[model samples]
Target: MKKFLGALALALALISPVAANPIIIPGDKNQRLIANNLYLTTDSLFAAYMSENLEQRRLAEMYVIGVIASSEGESWCGFKIASPDAVQEQVYIGLKSASEKLPKSRPAAAIKSRLKEILPCKK
Candidate 1:
């Protein structure tokens, strides 16, 4: 009985991490929704060009900065932002607009689409 219990504990330990970290494929709707929830919650705090939730805003800014850095020198999102500050402003504005017009829209996707529309790649 002790051996069986030890085996069960080992099995659970092996499975716990896998269960905690579910695979999220790119472009998956559910994955997008989950990712957007984080941004949307933070973006919602923006009021009159400032965020009411500074901590959340800081986190969102970091996330947007990372995305911008990753997209540098590429037309991945078809945006030609000239500066990091510009990119941050655009992302926040895009997120705010998305939250107003399409409250349930995925933020990353929405911001990408918005950037493509307003700041299309100049080729």
Candidate 2:
């Protein structure tokens, strides 16, 4: 048991630094670019919205819904959406407009920023 534990500690120590460093292939600049921009962007969200696949559309709607739900009750930019269907439509319109205007922005940030404009909380 002692020998096995020592070997495990030595193995983990050797693997830690390799895991910490990102793998960069020579002359593969695109790989580094992709690695840096791994998170969802508005362009991808717009693609999902325009996709013919039902699942893609559903997931995009859900993503918008999540952004809305998370921003609720915040005194600054909270919004009161009427119904699930209506909220989806309204937010989609907002997202579509935002995608056209700000394609490079993060979707969650875009949606949150538009919440007050699209569905302002009643004062």
Candidate 3:
């Protein structure tokens, strides 16, 4: 038992640093650039969703919905917010409206603000 404990401690000590420090590959920068650019405009967002894999598309759509839901409430844009499907549609329309109204530089903020006019839920 003593030998086993000593070996375990040694193994953990050796592995700890490697576990803590992640390796930054060269492509990580490019990936980050692409992701950052995705949120810059509704066109970019929609293009990425259409071009990326199904999982990526789903995540992008979910991100749009989450932003609207979080900024407002679950009952976003004056929609009933009854189910996921309904919420998704409302989010899509809101995003579309925002994209048309907002400029490219501040897409997220513009979208949020545009939503106020497009779908201001009565308190």
Best by lDDT, which number? 2
Against the reference, the lDDT scores of all candidates come to 0.50, 0.60, 0.49
**Candidate 2 residue lDDT tens string, 1-123:** 866865675455445432231221223333343342246568677677666767656766666766777876652244334556765666677678878898777877777666566666667
**Candidate 2 deviant stretches above 4 angstroms:** 1-38, 75-81
Q: Hey, what RMSD does candidate 1 come out at?
A: 10.9
For lDDT, candidate 1 versus 3, the one ahead is 1
Candidate 3 pairs with clashing backbones: none
**lDDT (tens digit, per residue) of candidate 3 on 23-116:** 1112333344333334345644544344435654664565566666677652245345345565456556655665556524444554466566
Tens digits of per-residue lDDT for model 1, 1-123: 866865675456445432231221223333442443343432342331244445545645555556555654452443344465666667777877876777555555655665666567656
What would you estimate as the lDDT of candidate 3? 0.49
Backbone clash tally for model 2?
A: 0
On TM-score, the candidate that comes out on top is: 2
The CA root-mean-square deviation of candidate 2, after full C-alpha superposition on the true structure, stands at 12.3
> Roughly what TM-score does model 1 have, to 2 decimal places?
0.49
